[model samples]
Target: FLNKGFNVVDSSVATGKIEVSNAYKIADLTDAGAISVGKQLGAEVIVKGKALAKEGPRNTGSKVGSYIADITASALRVDNGAVLGSARGHGVSRNISEVTGGTEALEKAAREASGKIIDQIIAKWSGEVSGGGLIQLTVRGIGEYSDFVKFKDIIQGQIRGVQAIYQRSLEGGIAVLDVEMKGNAQQLSDEIARKNFGGIPVKVIGASANTVEVSLGGAVSAKTMSTPPSSPPAAQPSPPVPAAQETSSFFEADEYLVFSGDRDENGRVGKMVTRPTATNPEGEFLMYHDGQKVWSKFFKAVRSAAASELQLGSRIYFFEGNHKEGVYYSPKDKSEARLESWWRDPVTDNSLVNNRGIVTVGRYRVDVSNAFVEKK
Candidate 1:
């Protein structure tokens, strides 16, 4: 749901399992362990959801099988346990995959419900949903596939009001949408500032009391994010080992994914991390500082490489993670070092994509001989 500008953290089975008996249960973060989760993942807000399509009996519809998916969810601010929004919605799908067992209906339903949940969050944070109508919306930059669909869904399904959406034009990567909403233009702008429809984030440049104008670099506001100005609580750099709270941030991070392997010769461990924000967003970016962070695992692993192939200790960056998992780098030699790991193929029946016949695929990473040509 947060694949857009919102950080996609991995609480990783840590939030535990929240099961409901075929009813929408409003989750209470206070008792559901919200603080531990907040500290674990440096998230501004958290959205929790689930689907129950296979609970009863097998689908008995068409050849592909008919499935109904219902999703109920709520949001919370990590810094302070404050419930932001809660909602439930359902969707119907006939694209059930028996060969690979992927729930298309459930995913469809969840997205439908999640979009509504986000609307509520925006309403709560920006204080707008109830009063708005006929606002001009101009979105430019990053008009990708995901953005188009999500924007369409939001306009079509406003929680309270929004009678019609008239498309003015879509040209030169700029889209002009006329939202027949009930609130004022400023209210609409404030609400748009908080949303990350699908994976596209649009910025509200300025909104007249009468008309709202939004651009694309992904609109963002701390109030809507639920993260106070003092989020992530910068830690002191004295101790090599971080406090328990700091440790959770690393495990919960969605910005840079960190992986661990056996310890290096110098008591260090191999770790691979990626900075999703710095990447090209349009293409795969696999380099340090530019769009990737390699120090923790890349440099440490290379530091322990045969004959110090990376020539360890050229320039060390004050790594983002804790001290022990810190990264070191040398621009000249760091780019050439290769690494390998496992990856899971998507749940699909296509043998071409799932040749291994299972999710886990071993020996994935390989070092390219040529250096990356930096894009201007």
Candidate 2:
């Protein structure tokens, strides 16, 4: 029966006497155990049987007795424990005295039992009662980038009842595509591996219920490190220097001086003084009462006062004179007319004044003796 491709699970006894050794092992069959084992083994049809034999009338002076054998077979669906069908076969042997022919009788009984089982199994399988299920196929591979979608369609077309869901991941510097099966996952997985669908190799990653996941590279890892860095370090700005406080006390009067001249020889007269002013043509002058210019001398005395304010070095400005509008003066013109013009206002027709100053000694102070003296 096994050679005939029929799975025969036997349990039979002949009239409480085992005609065949170890035949009782075949007799102890349970529907539950058979169904459980059959389902576990993926069997579509399960064959179970029972046999009975009794001695017939014995021939005169012969050591043989006529024997009648009855056999019953059943086919069941393992999936849902449904019985497909059942059949029984009965046969009588005329010569029952020969012990040598017992083997033949047993074989004949087994054959008859299996034939009945197979006939019922086939009849039910071909009938409307047989259940129909689907097998889905999944295919995946790696090659040309454009081939991913094409391969998926090809696999879906070649395998019936198969729906392909494609996914991609980068692994080992290669892009991998996974084709998942949506029906009869295991069957389709086996089919894909066997048929080599999509003209490329396929592998089964996992399967459950109606879905099977297939990956390229045949068991290759799907983990990828292809994502780029999310963020980068921000650039930093240079530190700033604390600005000096702009207070009058921070500046001294003497530091504002540019140049000093000698006093005249007469005690009543002094030498001409040239000093910087806060005006266009920046170095201007003031006439002193002693016939000595004291603007430069007065500025020299206060030169050290504004030393901290001379960031770009001392600038010389000529003082014109003190007025109600404030001190008027001019800037010392440089070779660059653009710089000179920047210090002068075109609209106001007035010179842009800076911080340097020129002062008249008699206007602020009364000291006139030895105020101007010529160098010996």
Candidate 3:
């Protein structure tokens, strides 16, 4: 058996030379010893058999009968104390007077008994000991993005009795695998698709002669390993302003300052002339405009105009009315008009001025030609 490259264990041949080492264990036919030996040696089953040799009478021509050889063999399982199989054989010598040939007859009887016993045992255990073979696999043309170890583990877990021993690198990005097979290989290929590795699509690239060599090739799926979080909307650029509209010009007048005071510097210079000028409290000059004492109307119009222009910051001011009847000028437009109003030192309070007297008002306009101003 060893010369033919078959793994076989023989315990009776003590002087025989075999390449593989033999293991010897001392055990009796008792049930306890059989179970202990089975567990210790990691054997799935323990076989035990006995051979019995007997002498019987054979038919002769004249006398009743001469003595002949007989043998019986019985085999059983020691672990469970169950009778696994049994075989009995008998052999008779041609000459009854030949007592010296009894040894040869006994040996022949034993060999016949042993062969029958072995055949019975094998038939009983054939179902449990079949389909265990080695499977060699080769994987070729796998890209660097593929994780081979993880792929192997996935395949092994899905398939029954498939074990990846070791992977070796070959030329041109090829990998070889020594796998122990306990089942079919086609089932394993179907399982790989079901697992959906890395959420990417995959396909078998190539297969070797024994259907063991497998190659994978396909594009990665949209769902990658690392998923990104949802983000907020990005800021958009302001719309472009029409060039013709941007080139258009608009006139903007300064604030109108109106004041009422005594002309002769008298304690009671009643109802003097009133005038308006474009000026601030610090006497800074600006464009002047003449208008009625209607300060509220002018204030509303200028504010609305400035809002249409998209002005960010604008201001309006109220000053004392002039001594004139009902005329006003932009105080910020001229220096002499600002000094004339200051000399009266008139109380600029709105409540102090009567209906007949002109009141002062100041307002400013803004330019909205720029697109950036609308965005702000």
Determine which window of 10 residues in candidate 1 has minimal summed lDDT.
317-326
lDDT of each residue in 1-376, candidate 3, tens digit only: 1333434444345224422222333211333444454444434345443333334555556443333454533443432323334444555444344563454566666667667656655654452246433334665544543455445665666556664343433334555554545543444455544566564344554432123545544232222222222431121112222222221121123332222221221011011112224552222221121111112111111211222332223222211112212232223323323222211122222321234232322111111211111111
**Stretch of 10 with least lDDT, candidate 3:** 264-273
Query: What lDDT does the true structure give each of the candidates?
Result: 0.40, 0.38, 0.35
lDDT string, candidate 1, 250-306, tens digits = 121112222322221111112223322353322121222111212333122111112
Local lDDT at 202 for model 2 = 58
Q: Which ranges of candidate 1 are over 4 A from the true structure?
A: 1-4, 12-31, 55-62, 99-102, 128-376
Task: Using lDDT, give the best candidate's number.
Answer: 1
* Local distance difference test, candidate 3: 0.35
Please tell me which model should have the higher lDDT, number 1 or number 2: 1
User: Which residue runs of candidate 3 sit more than 4 Å off their true CA positions?
Assistant: 1-28, 31-47, 58-70, 74-84, 96-105, 124-126, 129-376
Badly placed stretches (over 4 Å) of model 2 are 2-28, 39-42, 96-102, 128-376
Given candidate 2, what's the lDDT at residue 277? 39
Best model per TM-score: 2
Candidate order by decreasing TM-score: 2, 1, 3
TM-score of each model, paired residue for residue: 0.28, 0.29, 0.24
